[model samples]
Target: MAIHLVGLALLMGVIISIYLPMITQTAKILGSGPMANIPFFAIALVSSIVIAIASGSRTEQFQKVATLPLWLLTAGVMSAGMIIGSSFLIPRIGIGAFFVLLVSGQVLAGMVFGYFGLFGVPASALTVGKVLGALLVIAGVYLVTFK
Candidate 1:
């Protein structure tokens, strides 16, 4: 089960990375301001609505959402920030560098979050391997970032 989940996670990671260039190009076309974020979210909202309707559990999901704290609902804000920031950075840094840096930061932050169990992530003791993996990611970012 764990191996299957890990594979699924890697697959999703690849998908998200592949999406970077698309958004970057859209940023170039739309001009990386409110214009970029607006259409992006509009599409996302529509897609989400379609999925929610198709789920056949829309009422249950809405009930679940209501039970959550207000702070939790602000995840959309974080998603917006990620898209807006990525729109600006991907074109400037180039896709490879932006993705490398993003993955590096995610790994490092994940290490901290996993160790401390922040944001409800299950606690895992930091090990030498985890730190080494993060260092390798940083090194990769450096290689991808510089000429």
Candidate 2:
């Protein structure tokens, strides 16, 4: 379990390193506005299709065809909206700030959802340490962008 945790941490670190740079470049291409979402949509479309084929699944059978929840659909739509919105925002804010705000938003949302046991996550509250850590991340974002 410890090894698995370490491996996952390392993998996430690598992903962050790669993703941040890509976001910066994408922002540059899209002029730091919401238009960046076009590439996001294209990537999502290709990935979804690839994943479906690789996993031997389709939208109809993706997750219980008839019982698809509205909440999930809403979340999916919201994510797409962010992708589009980010395209426009990235150039102005820069990728570092963009990711900081984006990740912080995710962390806040995740904690809220986890606390309420929403989306199958176990109920939990944000600890003081987590709050501090988030603050530090925000501070880091400020330093990275403004300084």
Candidate 3:
């Protein structure tokens, strides 16, 4: 269990620490090229499709997705907006500020989501500790971006 937890942590860390920068740079470069965001995201979509098919989970995943509520289908639309926004914003804001603000927004939204048990997630009360942790994240973001 501990090993699995560590592996998951490492995976997330790599996504944030390494993958995010690479993708952001790719977006920036592609934004400057003649092709622009469409080709970049198209490639990403193709890559994801290939990976999903290769993983042999597509059948089960599609079945599950078919059963999901209509509102859940909007996730793809939201993801497209994030990808497009990131392609445009990262070049202007720089990765540091962009990620900081992105993470801050995610944390804030997570708090609300958890508090209200949104998206069928189990209800988790917003304790004082959670608020303090969020405040610390905000302060950290301010420190990182301003200093």
lDDT of 3 by residue, 41-144 (tens): 68888998899999886887867867888888898778666666766777787778888888899889989988899977788999999999999999989998
Q: Which wins on TM-score, candidate 1 or candidate 2?
A: 1
List the candidates' TM-scores in order: 0.86, 0.64, 0.74
Pairs that collide, model 3? none
Native-referenced Cα lDDT, model 3: 0.77
What number of backbone clashes does candidate 2 have, counting pairs of residues 3 or more apart or in separate chains? Answer: 8
Candidate 1 colliding pairs, count: 0
TM-score of 2: 0.64
Which pairs clash in the backbone of model 2? 32-88, 32-91, 33-87, 33-88, 33-89, 34-87, 34-88, 36-87
The superposed Cα distance between candidate 1 and the true structure at residue 5, in angstroms, equals 3.3
lDDT of 1 by residue, 1-147 (tens): 699999999999898887656666787887664467777789988999899889786877877876889899789888877887888887677777887788888889999999999999999998989888888887787778885
